[model samples]
Target: MANIIKKIKRKHKKKKLQAERAKMEQSRQNRTPEDAYQERLSKHRSAVIRRAVMTVVAVAAVATLFFFYMEKRSYHNYKILSASEQEDVVATNYAEMSGKILRYSPDGASLVSDTMDTYWSTLYEMQNPVADVRDDRAVIADQDGTLLEMFDKDGETGSVTTSYNIIKARVSSSGMVAAILDGGDATWINFYGSDGTLIAENQTHLADPGYPLDVAVSDSGDIMMVAYQFVDGSETTSYVAFYNFGDVGQSEDDRIVSGYTYDGVVIPQIMYLDGNRSAAIRDDGFTLYKGSQIPKEVETIKVDKEIVSTFYDDNIIGLVFKNGDKDKPYTMRGYSTDGSLKFEKKFNIPYTTIKASGGNILLYNSSQISVMNSRGVEKYSGTVDGTISDFIKTGWNRYLLVLDNGVDVIKLS
Candidate 1:
């Protein structure tokens, strides 16, 4: 009976071990092949996504580096041209008609070529010489208007003697000269042709439109715009009158084609942008006029800031004012002939002289010069060797720099 009991126990133990082995096999078989494949596929996708993300990051880093490299390459400093010299040039002018430069001294005026060669020189007696240079011609006159000399790139064209003492004079591109003369009780505006012939003359009396503050003549010397100021009681009135001297204006009374009156505004400066367009700059703002014979007011722009300086070219007007900032000394605002504000920018450097040429604004002092385009982008800023007294644009990126020592032709690239 003991042997039988021991055999049963052995058999039961073997059966229990076999059942455990079978259960282990079944569990292993229940893990599906598809499930294992899905797990491996998910791991592969994650690896691919990680690699793509890393590639994108690498590309972005490279692109940023390239952008900075290109930006650094684009920026350039000014280069001094091979041509430089020291001269005793008192005044300088560029003639666009003949593509030459004229340097004036106490002795006379010398016309120079682009190669710095003197083409011609003329001697004359000039005291306090004021020169008006245009694309076509140049006119040099003394403060007293005693001697008026008109010349071009070739040589002297004509000379005229003023009847009254000259307050100011301007020359047009067409060689026409306009002079404002002091006539004691009244002011006289005289127009001279390129041949020194008197084209037209007018006198502004105090009893009429008061005193003539400014005068501008057309390129053809056929149209004239005058700004007059008069005080009525406690209020001051300003008038911008257009006079036509052509055949169309001969029938009109006083040859006065049109006139505009402004109360409490002083129009101190008047200019002719072209043969048809005129501008009157007042203490507050400016007014633009358009017409051939009869000028009509088309636009008016009012400025609120304190005007420090103003400049204009044939197509644009620039006003520089203080914006109450310590870092920035002045703000330059540009306007088109149609009264559109084209650009505005702040200048960090102080400038003694400001001018508008072509489509750019130039600001310079004794040691430094800066140029800003029409879009208000600073194209160039650099230190000059000596004190710059005057400068003229000889080429697109070149300038005829007149210094205290002499004149230099420089290139700004």
Candidate 2:
């Protein structure tokens, strides 16, 4: 009976050992090699994804902080000048040569000196008067482009009567005038000397170079640039042609010195920087031309952003575009005649008009005015107390603010 009991105890112990071994094998089988590898890979992938997400968040936070700092800097640099009130100003312009201010209305035009004294006022039969002021002369033409009268600080200089209605007119610094006339079946680009003598005329037809969209004359009245636009089916083409009446263009065909044709461009504004330099502003961008006899293509600037507005004077071309930011509404960019970017700046104000003078730019509306240098640096920002009708630059750092009641000279240094 003792031997049997001992054998039973040994059997029980063996069964217990077997059960333990089976459980260990089952646990090893459940954790397979493929399952272990997959588990390790999932942990590693999760860690990598978490690191990537943290890096992105850090970068975004830095970018947002940088933009906020830049906006604060811009606001801190802005300034406000003194305010004044003015009234009954229809149009205003500044003559840099004589240091005088020109105020015009439908009734007449007046030239005022720096002392606010009216030098002269000339009355004409003007239904809608449009004035263009340069350094030495000012030209007031009817909105219809027909009756054009030139004036100086002294008095009326010359007048030109057009046979066809005038669509647009521009005067050079020396009083040379170029007018685009609306002919019946065609259009005419007429160039006149300072004394209102017809210098040259080019009749543009729809079939040849198309209609003249814009015209510009040289300071000496020796060259004329015309922007001609034509449509062929769904495609639109623009041609900027240089016409020279001087001896340098004698060898060219019909005085057509040089021209550039662009597809899918519509250039509505062209101006001569000087006798040899000219620029044409289009929807896409602007082209700078330089030559003696004819304008040679110097550089072509292509703008990526949508252009909101454009302003040009004798020397600088200014373009205002949306900045794609809510804090800064617009960006003003100035380019030189050689197609070099001179300055770029962002502003919050929505300017109604922009003008580039010698070394400065003037931006104004009915209530606000901003002055900036050629380098896109804001020099001053101020408000006109009363409702502003028109304003003109009296000096490099001065503006004749025309209010609804009177005119105030604002000096911003």
- Identify the leading candidate in terms of lDDT: 1
Candidate 1, residues 194-302, lDDT tens digits: the string is 8788888888787687788877777776787888889988999998888788887999988888989999998888888887888999888889998877789999999
Against the true structure, candidate 1 reaches a TM-score of: 0.77
C-alpha lDDT (0 to 100) for residue 220 of candidate 2: 74
Error of 1 at 103 (Å): 2.3
TM-score of each: 0.77, 0.75
Off by over 4 Å in 2: 1-87, 90-98
lDDT, candidate 2, 8-58, per-residue tens? 999999999999999988877899898889989999999999999999999
- Each candidate's clash count: 1, 8
Q: Lowest summed lDDT over 10 consecutive residues: which window, candidate 1?
A: 89-98
N/CA/C clash count, model 2: 8
